[model samples]
Target: MPRHGRLHIPGGCYHVMGRGLERRRIFYADADKQDFLDRLGETLARNGSQCVAWSVMTNHYHLLIRVGDQPLAKLMAPLLGGYAGHYNRRHHRSGYVFQNRYKSILCDADAYLLELVRYIHLNPLRAAMVKNLTDLDRYPWTGHSALMGHRKQDWQSVSEVLGLFARGLGTARRRYREFVVQGLEERDSDELLGGGLVRSYGGWEGLKRLRKEHVYCIGDERILGDSDFVERALAQDTLKVEQATQRIQAGWDLDRLIRRVSQYCGIKEEQLTQKARGNDLSLAKALICLWGSQELKLSLREIAHRLSISQPAASQWVNRGRKFCRELGIEFEVIDS
Candidate 1:
C-alpha cells in the first residue's frame, strides 16, 4: 500500500520514533549519544520546533515535539542525516545507521500530553538501561533527568511539561516525579506507539464505545485522537493543502499577506499590533490569523509572537477569522491547478 502523506499542521503535538537499521545500536557510547543530542538541539532550534519529551535508547529514540513553522520531516532530516554521517566516520562503519523512515503519530495534546511524557521518560527502565526511578533520574540519555532537575538539556521544554502538573515549579516537579513512578507499574503503552482510534484513545475501550454508538471512528495510523478530533484534523489538513495552493497562485507570503489584509481593511500594517476597538481592525487581524494559519501553516504561538499578543488571543482571532470567512463565503481564492 502507498504510505499516507505526512501530517504537518503547525502547533501540532507528535510522538516521533526512529530506530537504527536492523535494530542495531545507534549509540555505541556516551559520546555518540551526546553527539546525537547536540545535533538534535541544533536542528530543533533551527527549525523552530520544541521538544517536550525525548529518550535516546541504544537502538532507537523517541521524541515528543510540537511543530512550529517548519514541518517535522524538515526538522528530522538534517538531525538524522548529520548524526549518521558523524557516527559512520567516527566508528569506521558504513551504510545506513538509521531506519529509512521514522514513525510519527500526530497526537491530541489534551488527551495524551502528560501520558506521553511519562511513557517516553520511562523507556530507560523499560529497556533495562536503568534499574529504578532513582537511576532513571540520573540517566543522561533521557529527558527524565531534565524534568527531575537532575541534568539540564536546555532545549528540552521542562517547564512546559511541568506546567501541566502545577503552577509552581517546585510543586509541579514533585507531582511529576510521583506521576512517573506510577507509570512504571503500568503496562507498556502500545497504543501511544502507533495506530488510530485504538491507539489514540487508549485501546479497545474506545473502539467499543464507537461500536456501541454505531459511530464511525475517523482514524489513521498517523494520527491519535477521538473521532471528532480525527475528523477536525483531517479537515484541517485538507484546508492546509487547499489554502497553500491558493497562496501559491496569489504569490502571497507573510509580508504580502499583511499588506493585502491591511489594504483591504484600509488600516496601516503597523496598526495590526495595536489593541484598537475598530471593527475593520478586528477583521484585518482575523484575516491575518486565518491567512497565517491556513496559508502559511504557522503555529498559534508563532503568530502570537509576531502579533505581540498571547497565544490564546491568537487562537481566538483564528476562530473569529474562520467565522468571518464562513459568513462571507470567502473561501481561499481558488486557482486552476
Candidate 2:
C-alpha cells in the first residue's frame, strides 16, 4: 500500500502511536521509561505542544498531543531519535529500535479527547503491568497517576483534562476516575485504533446507516472525525495545493501576489506594502504574507524585506494570514492567471 501523507493542521489534536521493531519491548526498565518521558517533555516544550494523555508500554507507546506552532514531524524526529539512541547505548545494543513510521491519526478532539485519555492511561493495567485502578494510579509510567495527584508531571496537561469533568479539582479528579472505571469493561477498542469508514463513523453499522442516508464521508487512515470535519480538513488541504499550483503556473511573484491580495481586500497595494497600523492594513498584509510564504514558498526574510518589516513581524503576519484566510473562506483562484 502507498504511504498516506501526514495531515498537519496547526492546533490539531493527534493520537500518535509507535511500536518497537518486531514488537519487541521498547521500555526495558523504569529508567528507560523515564528517559523517554524526559525526552518527550523537552521536545514538546521546544515545539510548543501539550500532551493531553500518554502511556509507555513494554513494546509500544501512545500519545495524545495537541499540535502547537510546529508540525508533528518536527516534534517526533528529535524525540524518537534521541530516545532510541539513549536506549541502545544503555543496553549495549545497536539496531533499529522502532518500526517504520509512527501512526498519527488527526482526531476530533471534542469527540475523542476524554475517551483517548482513559484508553491510554489504562494501558498499563490492561497489559498486566498493574493490578487494579489503585495500582494503576501509582503505576508511574502512565499519565493516570499524574491526573490522580499521586504523581507530579509538570509537563502533562492535567488541569485541562480534569477541567472537562467538573469545576472543582477534587471533584473533577473523582469524576474522571469514575469515568475511567466505567470503561474498564470495554474490550479492545479497534475503532479507536483506526480503520477507514468503519472507525470514522464509530462502527460498521454506523457506516451502513450513513450510506443508507446518502451521507458519504471522506475517510482516511490518517484522520478520525465526523464527515463535516473530514471534508473541511481535506478541502483546506486541497485549497492549499491548488493555490500553490495556480500561483506557480501563473508565474506569480511577490509583487503580483500583493496586488491580488490588495484587490481582494479592497485595499491599495501602497497601503498594504507600506508600514500601516489598522485592521484593514493588517489583514491585507497578512494575506500577502501568507500567499508569499506558503503558496509562493518564499522565505520569511524575503517577505519581510519586501514589506519593510522585521522577520519576526512577517512570520507573525503569515500565521495571522492563515487564520484570516480561514475565517474569510478565502481561496486563491486562476481567474486572471
C-alpha RMSD values across all candidates: 10.8, 12.9
Question: TM-score per candidate, in order?
Answer: 0.65, 0.64
lDDT (tens digit, per residue) of candidate 2 on 224-294: 65443454455454464434555567788887888777776778777755766777888888877766765
| Model 1 score (lDDT) | 0.78
- Runs in model 2 deviating more than 4 A are 1-4, 195-221, 240-337
Candidate 2: residue 70 lDDT (0-100): 88
Tell me model 2's lDDT, rounded to 2 decimals: 0.78
lDDT of 1 by residue, 1-337 (tens): 4445576778889899999999999999999999989999999999999999999998999999999978888898999999999999999989999876888888866556778888998998988988888999889999999998989998999988886566688988898898887887789776777545433443445766777889755344466654445545665666754445455566766677778778888999899899959988998888787657655655556666777875546656876877888787664452111
